[model samples]
Target chain A: EAGVVQSPRYKIIEKKQPVAFWCNPISGHNTLYWYLQNLGQGPELLIRYENEEAVDDSQLPKDRFSAERLKGVDSTLKIQPAELGDSAVYLCASSRTVYNEQFFGPGTRLTVL
Target chain B: SQQGEEDPQALSIQEGENATMNCSYKTSINNLQWYRQNSGRGLVHLILIRSNEREKHSGRLRVTLDTSKKSSSLLITASRAADTASYFCATDSGATNKLIFGTGTLLAVQP
Candidate 1:
């Protein structure tokens, strides 16, 4: 069984530039999530998708951050005009359902200079 | 503020020794999970304990939860060099479908 997959393992962009990370969750998983982990800290949820519908996204910064799971299989997280504080690891995870254990993807490390 | 907080930010032990880490959280949760991460890669699920359950074991790993104190602990017996990594505890709060992770504990098992 293949694990969660993510692209662009590492990304470096200057402040005010835009960056986007992609994630493909495990097959047959119905719940997808996006999280941000800063240095020395744990992951914080940015958004959650239950079959292409965003069920929870309160923590996402509406002004600059956006995420979409078009078919509920793959997801994309975008940050426009990124700030230095946005530098962190972007993690994608998926579960069979809301209460199931999540499987994570190797995160995309974003560095905003 | 994170819902889960882990204690003993760092630990070091010999290969044959045991390593334990603790986690505390606020509010009620449906379940708690343990994960291991090597370097900056993805996390591997180690174990999960539901709220009603007190203790769970898998292979050489053990996890215990105390609902009254809103705390949990992970124990790895006879640790090996491959166990050198960061361990984290995540909570599944009742309201949200998301899991909030704790500040990890860095474990260095010397061979």
Candidate 2:
């Protein structure tokens, strides 16, 4: 089976611009997650979805960051008025269940100048 | 805030040698998992050990969890150059079951 897939493996945007990342989870997976990773650091959870409901998104920056999984299979994370500090890798992952092993996508490397 | 912290930010080893990395977390956890990420790539799950379990092995990887000490260690035996990557430990804690990752340890294996 194919693993989780993410679009636009790399993206470059200027500050104050808008940027979006897309993700397609593995077949039959019921949970999806979005994470932000900075240089020399591990990934931090931004949002998590169980089916079409965002079960955990307390860490997401509501002022600028938003994510949605309309059909429960694909998800999109958007950052509006991007800032210089927003430059980092945006990763998406999927799992069979909430407590199961997660499969990750090759992440979109976003650079905000 | 990261709940786990990995010791030795970086390590270098030669092929056929063994590598061990440690992780310490601050909260009570249901399970702890280890993952490997190649340079510029996504993470790949390595092993998972439950709080009730002590040690588990998969192929060349051995993971041990000490819930009492709130720490865990990963051992890769007879390492290969292909094992050159960053290793992370994530704790599954809280009611959300969200994984809180550690700062990761970069390992370089020389062939």
Instruction: Name the best candidate (by TM-score).
Output: 2
Off by over 4 Å in 1: none
| For candidate 1, the TM-score of chain A alone relative to the native chain A | 0.98
Question: Which residue pairs in model 2 clash with each other?
Answer: none
Residue range B36-94, candidate 1, lDDT tens digits: 99875568899999999999999999999999999999999999999999999999877
Show model 2 residue runs off by greater than 4 Å: none
Summing lDDT over every window of 10 consecutive residues in candidate 1 chain A, give the lowest-scoring window: A95-104
DockQ of each: 0.82, 0.82
The ten-residue window of minimal lDDT in model 2 chain A covers A97-106
| Per-residue lDDT of candidate 2, residues B15-98 (tens digit) | 999999999999999899999999555799999999899999999999999998999999999999999999999999856799
Top-scoring candidate (lDDT): 2
Candidate 1: clashing pairs of residues: none
